[model samples]
Target: MTDPGAYPNPGQHPTPHEQPPRTRRRRWPWLVIGVPVLLFGACGVAVVTSVAGGNDTTVTPGPAAGDTDGGAPDRGPDFPGKLDHDTAAAAGATITRDELAYTVSPLEAVDTVLGSYLCSTVTIDNVGTTQNDFNGYTDWSLQDTGGAIRDATFGPDRPMLNSGQIAPGGRATGSVCFDDRTGATPGTYVVLFEDTFSLSTDRLAWINAL
Candidate 1:
């Protein structure tokens, strides 16, 4: 082997003015590389958030859990009967006094001699094969509807036509009257009578002029 200190060294200490060689890697190379990737990820998230935030939201009504409207509504204090307006009106009518019908006839307009009340009469004829049902009870009235219903009266509109009973095959005449000669104007009146069942006579009068 050569003398220990005698072999020339690849590099020696430089002069006072000379510079030393640099290492290949930087001290903070990971930070410089990672910063760009982190910035790109942050920028992507911001863009997505902005796009979503720019939209407007609206409220919408969702479906009910079950179908409740399909059924009938609760109707209290039945006016005449259990049947609705269409069903009750569609039922057939009769003339002469029968056990199932009443003999209703139209009469001349009679002013309530008692007072301002005016009454229009309609003769009833229960032309059915049975005996008259209106015997002893007075449950007669007219569904006199041409305008708005006059809820104002002595009592309910029901009592307006309820009068003395008529026998079967026997003719009974009914008079529809409104008190004070008011509210009820000139129009069509449906003479309704029910002894066992119900019967109505279509007779109209110019009872009260508007």
Candidate 2:
């Protein structure tokens, strides 16, 4: 027979089997912390991959210095010097600017309905390998001794300078007239010629004095 004392009271202390299962320690807390950690690690890996890919980007270069669509390199005018009467007569008042060569004859007086006008024969030769344009109305001007400037005008009795494209090594000639509103003599003016389409701002000039 077992003594009554040998078995404890059923309610005094519970056996392991009788105790409520250790409440599982709420493992959901660990799952929640671990899931966020795993997600953050994945995002870190994605950022690293994106940064690595950015290093392989390519860049294109621009056109080289002095490069042009035309075969010849573009250049400014090479002025020989300003020409006066004797030198102009000997040299024909010639000047080369960029790809064009200009020649001007001595000025002569012409009668016009508006007023007296100074006229000259103007010639242009395309010395470059590429074609170039010329506009007589806009490219020619006359400056008098009094520093007054006048643009080229039409002379009814004279053939006007033809404005158009000039092929390489080709030349054109015609008359350019400017109104003499100041009554200045023909030889007391300066003839100016420039290329309207050229990148250079220089003007070729000749003194009309004889």
Candidate 3:
């Protein structure tokens, strides 16, 4: 009513309580900064977990590659038996104990004798001037690893080599049988030969592989 046309437009002037447009509050800047901080925090937690687990873990060791059960090999048939001889006689075929040259064959399998018997060809050469007497069955016997003894020529089985006499420089060759009836297991058996004259002298001359 009082000269309204001369007054300014109300829409053009902002009131004291009316604020300016906020310019969308720049949401992209906050998103970029906050996203990077969140990613850094996640990576830091993962690195810390890995390092802590590495220190707590324990590594165990294994046995040496070449270690064994800690035991000595058993003495067996392959081992050569003992011989009583001087240094001079050791090299020659003649044994000093009896002044004889003897050769024995490897044990043979035979089913003729009772139970189980091992046969072999034995040759004894009298290297001395005097005669040598031998009772193959009585003089030779089987001795197992347990030291159990079994007599030879049991029942009617004749000794392949019998009690006989040999002249000087004479060689006698024949088969000898050994009985394995002592229930001793087959391992290393010491074939002991004894001189009738010297009963105390028993020589472990051969080993039966069995």
TM-score of each: 0.31, 0.53, 0.48
Per residue, candidate 3 scores C-alpha lDDT tens digits across 113-148 of: 447666666777787789977777777765566666
By TM-score, rank the candidates, best first: 2, 3, 1
Alpha-carbon lDDT of model 2: 0.65
* Model 2, position 33: C-alpha lDDT score: 97
Total clashing pairs in model 3: 0
Query: How would you order the candidates by lDDT, starting with the best?
Result: 2, 3, 1
The lDDT, on a scale of 0 to 1, for candidate 1 is 0.38
**Cα misplacement distance, residue 194 of candidate 3 (Å):** 0.9
Residue 161, model 1: lDDT of 38
Tens digits of per-residue lDDT, candidate 1, 22-120, equal 668775889989999999999988866644431221111111011225654322112332333111221122222222332233322434445454344
Worst lDDT 10-window in candidate 1: 57-66
Candidate lDDT scores, in order, read 0.38, 0.65, 0.54
Tally clashes: model 2: 0
Off by over 4 Å in 1: 1-109, 126-130, 135-138, 143-168, 174-176, 195-210
lDDT of 2 by residue, 103-166 (tens): 7887888877767888889888888899988887888887776666789998768889968989
RMSD of 1: 27.7
